[model samples]
Target: MRRNAQALFGLVILLAGIAAVVATRDWKIQTAMYPRVVGIPLVILAAIEVVLSLRGAPEGERQAVDTALSETLPPDVTARRTRVAFTWIVGFFLAIVLIGFPAAVPLFMLAYLRGQGRESWALSLVLAGVAWLAFELIFDRVLHLPFAEGLLLQILRR
Candidate 1:
């Protein structure tokens, strides 16, 4: 039952990626760059997931680089951790929507590193600075991608 559900989820994601890629076919190369870059990998990975899920590997045969928490953690602890993870995911999404990616990426990285990971302040600051610099240099300066202004920025400018 779980495997079937996982396969279904992967199929849905694969279909969504295909739709996005197809919808951008008429767009100019500059406009389609982001979607194509993201969508193609999304489709490919989701297909792989669906195939794996359908193959139904034994529980002990799962090949993960990291340890699995599902077997070790108590249900309540797992649920709590899942909630926290989703909270961070939603928070990051909201941050991006509110502030745009170039700003949100470093802010999210710093917040996650300091607040969740409890890294040294200096390390967090340096990592965040590097992330921001790389994003600006690669996407803005080199690729010249036009990122959408955040809703907050748009409203503030008007």
Candidate 2:
């Protein structure tokens, strides 16, 4: 039952994303190279998810573990963790929008690692720096993406 619910939920999200991509495809702004390149894969993945969900679970696996986990885990704990994770994700996106990609990416990564109870500040810093390097140095710098310049860019412009 739980697996069925999860599969159904995934299916719904996949379908919704596909619908959004398709419905917006005709917009003049979407005619650029980026939209089609991104949209095609999104549509394909969503279609795959729909097919998998409709196919149902594999036959050989016993259902006992699923039932046990569903019963054993406290509902409150699940709900709380879900809420916290969702909040963190939303906050990360908000940070990106407000502070720009370069700054927000590292901050969000550090915050999430800390929130997960990682106590090593040094490790977190290293990880965050590496992530920034990969995204900013490798992707944005090398690939020449117009990454959001944030407050720094605005100040520099002045």
Scored by lDDT, the top model is 1
* Cα misplacement distance, residue 139 of candidate 2 (Å): 1.8
Weakest lDDT window of 10 consecutive positions for candidate 2: 62-71
Q: Give a tens-digit lDDT track for model 2, residues 51-136.
A: 66667646465565643534456878987887887898899887877779888988988887776857589888888889988998
What are the runs in model 1 whose C-alpha is more than 4 Å off?
1-69
Error of 2 at 24 (Å): 16
* Model 1: per-residue Cα lDDT over 3-113, one tens digit each: 998899989999998999999999999999999999999999998888988998565856679865565787679879899999999999999899898889999999999
Considering summed lDDT, which 10 consecutive residues are worst modelled in model 1? 61-70
Instruction: Please report the TM-score between candidate 1 and the true structure.
Output: 0.56
